[model samples]
Target: MNKIADYIQTAKLESDKPFCAFLYDLDHLRAHVQARVDSMPANTRYFYAIKANSELPILRALAPIVHGFEVASIGEVRKVRSVSQDTPIIFGGPGKSDEELIGALEHNVSLIHVESMHELRRLNELCAKRDTVMPILLRVNLRGPLPTATLAMGGRPTQFGIDEMQIAEAIQLAKSLPHVKLEGFHLHSLSNNLNAAEHVKLVKYYIERIKGWAAEHDLELSYLNAGGGIGVNYADLEDQFDWDLFVGGLQPMLEANLPENMTVLFECGRYNTASCGYYAVEVLDIKENHGKTYAIIRGGTQHFRLPVSWQHNHPFVVVPSERWEYGFERKGVEDQQLTVVGQLCTPKDVLASDVTVPNLRIGDVILFLYAGAYGWSISHHDFLSHPHPDHIYLGGDDHV
Candidate 1:
């Protein structure tokens, strides 16, 4: 297992990762998974959510290891089908068309997560007409902080889930429909400050809620679906999440509350695959303004582009031929502020503001750190005039 430290060391020595590099530290990511899977009780399942980072290598790495795949669109559904036929498939996202629903049904996937009453009702009607029992998971509107915290994303008005007020009525509808099986409930809080421990807290909370609700409605609950917001901190490598501590914190709770025969399902998309991609591009020129210097790279927001996301700046690194003795400055000197801007026509094309690198030169390539998640896929403009950077998948048993 290559620790983050080992990856960094090897990268510094290899000398080949110069043009552009994302440096997917999946070795660390998989170590996190291995630690958790080892501790999790039987029947607990993890599903690699496809939206976060859907590169083929990332999918291939996760497919053989995870219990199933969770898809939000027919395109994602097709991606899963291309990989493994036996991999349990779960479909999600709102506004799925009738054709999409029909396709999902045709695939005989494990479950479909529905967001609205209209969708639920429509899916029920379709299942009845087809004379097939469609397995369904109810997405709840959990807002704010989840359990173990006062605020809630597992608690109201969350657009992704059905409103809390609608739960009982939906259940009644399910009981009478005779076609949709209410397998379990699902919740997803965006990437935030939670590790395996907080995730387990959510699971335990759901178990109690599901059990209590099952008793009230005289229903049998056989599944528990937990939302995926697994977070990966790329800026501070040492701040890497401790998956063992996380799994240790939740394993006992899950073992205690999970109903017998219930399959615990996890939807993890980003954290699972984000570490495996690398985006590389060469520097086109360098410009000097006042006392500051800037390196204009061939790729900008039009290519491997990511600026501030979720209100945080993305990680990036400038590759220098010689090892520098002085540390890289996080902020520029009072008179030396080199703002890196993308080549796009819009002013919003700025990539970083007031960033100081290794006194960048014309031919130096600036490598964006942890760019595997979006890189060329999210940044390229179909309408732009700039040439697109080529995407590559460096093969390794360990995710690329």
Candidate 2:
């Protein structure tokens, strides 16, 4: 049997209950992460962005590979600590509570990326109470135009980081603070960028801009954090962000231009974990509506919301079923287009719209690809009181 058939057979044997199984190939995930880690320059560090896929198994598998983790919330910090206590971690976000800051200090996290002037002061105040100097990266929203990507977090006015225009003053203010040690800068702006060359340019741009700022201020920075926005091409499977080309371009640039003392850290989230996962939902009913075919599955956008959020058609494969008990023909539409929807009553609960599929049937399964990263966590699970999907890890003797 093929991979799709194998997954469907496994699902059938594991549970008679209705579920959407999120299958992960840990071996693939390990190799993918290791390849990136191996390709990084000597001065560059690789940190897995936990926001991508924080599942315990995923984190556990990556603990032995990645240099450390980049987390946005205190919960994430706690989660990482639970998995591996010794690994380095960097905490960053737009809004962090005083308790969270204190927790980070108590735990002695590797670094914290200060998002704003107020947050800088807040962190300083919290650090003063502990009588400890906290290392920080001034998260800068660059002054120039944002990089071309599906989502831009910086460049324009947003809640992410301190604007580039005010960095000098922020640095000056940090100098006065006794408890906060200003180390470097963190620039993370774009997401889902398909162009590998453009991402390389963005990383170089960050380095040069930070070098200029450091020269003007007469500061000795320790690291320039090229925050993770490295993207995956969901639209075209064949067209991807060429990792080998990206690493090839980065190696020469860093060797020639990067300051010897300053190390660069890359916090990759989506790009690292996106490809190792697959979401499989069984087709419950197939019908024609308004001259269009719709395959209503046991789950919907509440479970897997990436398609709706991106407003793009998600790619899926049809797993054919041989057991048809009814005295009638199998309900299917071959070579034609159909919309895949969930069990929810709302019209917004669509997973794919007008996508091409071959020989789809009611008893068959629809395996959604490229669902490893944002599929599990980003969805609104409580929209309806449906049972959660069963998260199944595909590889490893202990997990399968």
Indicate which candidate wins on TM-score: 2
Quality of model 2 by C-alpha lDDT: 0.86
Q: Per-residue lDDT tens digits of candidate 2, residues 271-305?
A: 99888888888888999988998999988888888
Write one digit per residue (lDDT tens) for candidate 1, span 1-400. Answer: 1233344344545554334334455554566445555566677788877777665656776676777889888888888888787789999887888888888998778899888888888988888889998989887765434644222454644457677667888778877777888988775644544466666676676777778778888987778787666666765746765666767766677677778888777787656655555444445555667765655556567665546343334555555433322464322223345766656667566566666554554434455655656555565555467655544444445432
Q: Tell me how far the alpha carbon of residue 15 in candidate 2 is from the true structure, in angstroms, after superposition.
A: 4.8
Query: Scored by Cα lDDT, where does model 1 land?
Result: 0.65
The TM-score of predicted model 2 comes to: 0.96
Q: What is the C-alpha lDDT of each candidate?
A: 0.65, 0.86
State the weakest 10-residue window (summed lDDT) of model 2.
Answer: 391-400
TM-score of each: 0.83, 0.96
Judge candidate 1 at residue 137 and give its lDDT. 86
Q: Give, for candidate 1, the lowest lDDT window spanning 10 residues.
A: 324-333
CA RMSD, predictions in order: 5.4, 1.7
